[model samples]
Target: MKLKKIGNVEANYSFWQVLVVCSGQEFLDSGEDLIASFEINSPDVRLVLCLTDDLLAARELLKSLAQKLIALSMYELELDGDVDDNQRALPYQIARNVLLQTRLPTLLLESCSFVRRDITLLPAELQKADCALKLRFNRKGISQKVLTNTLWLLPNSRVDRFLAQAISGMAKTTSENEERKAVYKALQACRGFLKVAALPGRYADRSHKHEGFIWVRLPKEKAETTAAREFREKTRARFARPPEVIILHPKQDLGTKSHLENNTFKRRVERLARPGRIAWRQMARLLVELSWERGKPARLVPLPQWKITKEALKNYEFAKTIFVPHLISAQLPHPKAYYYMQELVPMLFTVDRNGWGGVDSI
Candidate 1:
């Protein structure tokens, strides 16, 4: 897999600088008999393997096919990986652990429903995973000490089978070693974005142990404690662990599960969802308005409560809660012009753009 530049070919934001990808292999065994497994060797790390749901049906079909091949003096058996690699299938081991363990059930509960005072629906079966490993897409890039803080956010249900097929195609051509390396790189990059942290400078020989931080964002409109973030914070507050937030967007009403429509719709929505950007613009404006009301050029200003615009209410189904932290930084050069630009959520620990690096300590 290679990290490719995607979205907004002419966009100027620093966040849009990179995107990484890896081939997903499950598509090759789609609709066929397959078994996925995961191994929980460490209490800190849990690896999961997913397999085809039609394992029984594939077994039956294979039996009949095998008999016909045997009569032709060409006995054959379909196998997942090479005999050597099969002996070390991590996903298969992980799958078995998931089936036999009670912890999986507990974990599944969190993923069952997207619940909130305002946002009622969310994605299901989202998993939280953490791992520390050396990652690199190309030799030229630095391999800093890397950590993976992962949550399987909402699925693009529309791209289900087509995504599977795409993965299968990639798997057929790419070497397993190369694929693994590529996936590790992509995951590391994703984690860095969510945490507002830096990537590793180099690969470490020892297995990097990562930590999992999962929960929904706190809705600003509702009472703050009822938010998903509060629950996670309560659990790990004593340890002062770093936070990772994943915002999921679930499928609204489409019926088809194949990737074709999902990808098509995803592309269409990305174009139409300029509201997300617009919302930020409004936030920036609100901050400026508040600053002016204070009668000073303040370094920070609170974003005023947003009014639900009629145009936005017509298209979006879910209620959005715009959160403005105590600090605000206008990316625009002139403080006066900052009011016109879009505003991003301030980092948890950052007072402003200059102190963003200090966020982890808080």
Candidate 2:
């Protein structure tokens, strides 16, 4: 902190300008860790949370958070693809949208990341470069060629004048080629932010020079073998297991109702709740059948919509749900995290066409 005499009045400020983009609730717990670590040590650091896909949805949930110790702010960025609209995927959208955000020296991190040590060292290193890149890989070891989207840092000098449109344009093509291409595209964006070099107007060959990226290997998520086994047993015992289930999202299903009021809105809610009610109806049938066949109570599995389909998911995760990280894997912990979420937060009980647990619900 510093104080300067401006004419007669005194002014105060911190030594460094720091910004962090914490996106998604899957990372909110880890976000808390970032906040506590940064705020306690550096009182002047500014933290920003970026919530994508839905603005009203995120606002509703965030307002419910009662942690007074926490202090932060948010900006809603719509980062999702529309197949019917034939739109570009999120990565490109992210590249384009991020260009317009703050022009200060900034540090970007995902919801999965936690500050392992003092972050002061990170800023010091980043100050040397126009842009610094970091990525996490899924493989056992780290590779520069294969990059994961996790973090980026940039100083204000370059960001104040970077070409937003070009970086976003490159992302469009990069996302289409392959995973390696996507990695290359992000690198290009960093360079653009620094004004070191701008990508050519025309798309180039698959290969490109690797620049300032520093690969950091993160610890693998926790194990959930027992959770999966228990879930399987419960599913088999009660309902013979479902084939597939669709987890509806408000932005995709109920966005049309965003402007409705009174009776119009009520009608949309009833219409949207149809799917959840139907799933409950199926559960009811399965319960009755199990009661007759087993002569006693049988363990009911997660609602059909809650079943985990992706073999890669941990802790019986449903990808789109807030439980993806904390509740799905033993890795993340939160106030009303994972399976216990609905018990503490009533909004999580249902996800459907209408916004109940959704953002616009309130």
Candidate 3:
């Protein structure tokens, strides 16, 4: 590959300065898995065998995937302790830790996502945002938001300002290694802070800040949290060519799940599934119970209620109370739902629920 220079920076080469992360082999099996069928030049992306102390484990995986990855660029990072709550703070803390240390902008992405186009290949709208998040629609409705999903692209400098402050506050009280676990644990509650505050539209007075945040929808073919950004990118590409709506009738609706028409319509809807019947039935009952107990108008927990300032968040009571009835969710987050019928919820934590248990996806 050859590089061209423009105004002192390498033209296409410098644009996609990414730090691809594999939290465990479970998160990203290999670098090639990320690009999948795409024809990505190795020079365009950087890879990391991230988040495990065991170097030998990292080395073995890299040795196997040598066809797609450079041996030198894939390095191991170890955080102390089990620190293993998939929904909590590991990925954010990992990104925050790396971002604070590095000068270039780096995004945290899982191993399963297919990069049909590289970050260097992105448009100006996506490039300039404070954070580019993948989003999913919750059960409430198309208009209702669940939470931000996978494949987050946050600026290293901006992450320093938004994420690291809280981590630093706790660093004084804990050992460096313990801080890794603590940051993630605290992040469970702290996520409410970002979802409510850092995310632009949760409040009225909050700034949209150039409409700089992105919340992309996921593909129907795979698991919801897997960050199938390529699906929507393909849809956007299709729109530019022509508008072709393929309508299907009741008889046209295939009785079979694998019919071509059914698949096409599924793609158009973007959300092919919803939560299980049991979960919905259970949720209805819980809502009834809440109504009886409150005995008045159902309280509204309008977010952005707490001032979006460092001091307000750093205060003690905010974390504990954020998810209380009028705050985030109304229902007592009872037993974990056995399986979600839809793939709406994101990785960090489920929306509206305060406790740190994960909602299983269909």
Candidate 4:
């Protein structure tokens, strides 16, 4: 069967959107991390959640999340029978299918991995290129493999043709391992039409290993001075009026230090703080006091109590009504991991809120 086109290549989309495919309970556990990473790095970009599995719990999780993120959109993927059976390749197939329908410059984030740096800069990097992927190395360090699926960023100009060819290449493969090899071969086949660029030091894999990159921290005085200036600039751009209460929680740790060196902790803190500063910039108009409490827990200040917004409730209802029935009809087998999601839902609601507070502690 021929692929159906959903978007006009010539159509103009003013903004970029990121599509994240979530399937089972792993998403339920790490979904908030993905959202936080984006909020910290690319808050302006619209987030589209593509739920590939017919799991009611997965849809429910997104519905609750959408209320807090007004810019979020949710969609169900109608997977082809053969494609649906390949669990390893389902995400790629879903991405290839979604690329067919949208003209917006889109970045496909691997559902299991979260980015640590500013991903918004990738689209501009791809303006002159066809697609961009982060580079990874084997243990020997002599060979480099393109992380094509990990953080795939594609421009609208020729993305459809590229993905279509890549998917076609995968279709010819019989094994999961061969399917991946086919994608790499497909990149070579489309070299003339596609220019794959490398995004280094910008992403981390599932193991949370920082591939041979060394992080150099700026001098403390210079770093704070720069952060304050950038904070002021971003605040003015995002909000017409300044926010009344601006809380800076720099001490919060994301618990991603298992593979990081002790010295790299400070650099990681500094890197994480950039997103916090960007995220909370709108909450403060002027920089009144700048203080650094290195290695100290931020003293909690009483803020307004968070309540579930009407939009969130509405989205929950929409998920239960619209997505549930469709998912049921698809009859996708519910994985055992999905059962654990129910236990996490309440914790998800309590921990995830729109307010400026810490979800993790150092």
Candidate 5:
């Protein structure tokens, strides 16, 4: 049977809308340093994979995510013309048949619009297969609870098959222990909020360049008093690099919804929690500030959106300052926005230190 097209245009719009909605909602606000740290430590999570004919849809989703999410990218996989030839099939097809089927389908039920619509139409065998597979996979050497937690929601469908196969491929390339350890180590680094490189772009051929900045998370209650100073000193002693460690906490304000009536404000807040500054920008701002506070003459170039000026750049270098790039409004490609900031902050910091002053702004 020929697989039906879900209208790439429609699918793309649908996917884009999903991304925007998810991004706007408080999806990852629980101070999950794991996600942020893993992105910095592992490349796989950084790149997003899409398997559809809708290139426009894929692009839209990728661009939007690069702008909003911490670290993300999009890739399009092409299934071969030969329907029965499994070797030539696309990764997404495998994902559909495998990952989305088994317990993984449950995730779709929770978050994915596409998967939810199709779950009701899948067969019993596929569902059963998915559940069994998840049960077995979770028991395997891969001990990470996060991956298992995500897979427990798979639906019984061809989608499950595809995901299973894709995951298998990932498994073969890297052991589960390796992945889990990597995640743990990265989180350890980020918990105290160190500056790191940005995530790689997900598209198959995009240049993996550092884009911007992000402030990593720290362990809870460690930044309140003398503990904060000790933490900073420990960082200074360990890396010989005392970074500008910023402790971030959520704050409620009436800036965006203040103009509305009380009821409307309440509704908006209820619908979705307000988003904080992306981690990368927060890191960059800190890097600039710390360089100045330390009496290190540096060049600071604030990206255009951040609003640092060219004169500000000159000021940083002339008087124990840090010059950041001036903020520009050009739209960035996929994954660069959040991922690159990790690398970008340090690069800018290095530049400021080397007396490379008075360059381009924003």
Candidate 6:
């Protein structure tokens, strides 16, 4: 919150810099919710909120949360007199201007969307490629479309310049649909210059329900289309793997009325909750073990005679209600399950070298 120096810059090759475009009260509310929901202080992650409106209340709100954010920063963008009435171009304009000053890898996000803790997964993926994008299958199923609002770009002069130019082109377009098409085209053209990686699942935004499930959800006609077949083959050839397909258990059919019936729903919940409880207990036990190793004073030693501090007990109880539910939901054949297993689970079990446990305990 105090802009404390996190770690030696030379030790890390890159830091995670997040950019949020804020204009209205709704955006501010979602941005605030994002801050409160997850532990965003990863030492290498910084959040930048770009304010484009002259809202005094918005400034006050962000100021109040300054102490709550460890690496939060703000930028005020001045609108030109020729700005259009629709204000559709404002987000891209702000992003282009900010790109000029961004030295580290940057993630562009919409203020209305909330990213879960799996946001950390992008940095590692970005490190291996020049850019990472959240691609979703279009309704036509001929090709995949990029979610422009949530994009990741590594700090390369060419990549940044190319993306900025494409965004600039999009800003000048009057048609909303054409703007998206223009950006998608731009990404395709620049693929030769950039090694692009796909951000799997709903890591970018919860609104992307079909992020990683497109392969499994495709209709037979769409799947058999020549374009769709070529797209699949090209993706596998380029990335050395097919698009991830989330397989729901037969009993846990998603978005189906039959599966949501009384008895079926109860059975499905019970099946997922069993593993959720086991994962929760294992997490709690690790916290207790770390607390003992740290030599913390125990308020009470429960059965098994393991010394558990009040802080650890409170953390465990809090996780039981919050994290356990998330864990269960993550395991319920959702598109984000693999992301949870890859990033969230290990993050929860990790014990920091500073003697403080990871987010699960601290």
The clash count for each model shown is 21, 4, 5, 0, 70, 1
Write one digit per residue (lDDT tens) for candidate 1, span 32-114. Answer: 11111000000111112222233555445434432221001111112244222231223222222332331221111111111
Query: Among these predicted structures, which one has the highest lDDT?
Result: 6
In candidate 5, position 110 carries an lDDT of 12
Off by over 4 Å in 1: 1-266, 276-362
What's every prediction's RMSD, in angstroms?
21.0, 22.0, 24.6, 18.8, 20.8, 18.1
lDDT of 4 by residue, 165-189 (tens): 6666665456544655656666677
* Alpha carbon lDDT of each predicted model: 0.24, 0.33, 0.33, 0.41, 0.27, 0.43
Model 5 C-alpha lDDT per residue in residues 1-362, reported as the tens digit of each score: 12222211111101110101112122233112222222222211112233334345444543443332221222222335533223222332334443322222322111111110111112122323322112222443444422221222234333343343444344333444553433333333333433222121121101111221112222244342464334333322322322232111111212222332443323333322322323333444455445547754222222222223333233223232222222222321111111122234333322222122232132
Candidate 2 collision pairs: 27-111, 57-359, 315-328, 327-338
The TM-scores, one per candidate, come to 0.19, 0.36, 0.37, 0.50, 0.21, 0.50
> What would the per-residue lDDT of candidate 6 be over residues 165-184, giving only the tens digit for each residue?
56666655776466667666
After superposing candidate 4, which stretches have Cα over 4 Å from the reference? 1-14, 70-84, 136-144, 153-157, 172-177, 204-362
User: How does candidate 4 fare on TM-score?
Assistant: 0.50
Worst 10 residues of 4 by lDDT: 334-343
Which is better, 1 or 5, measured by lDDT? 5
Candidate order by lDDT, decreasing, is 6, 4, 3, 2, 5, 1
lDDT of 6 at 94: 55
Model 1, position 168: C-alpha lDDT score = 34
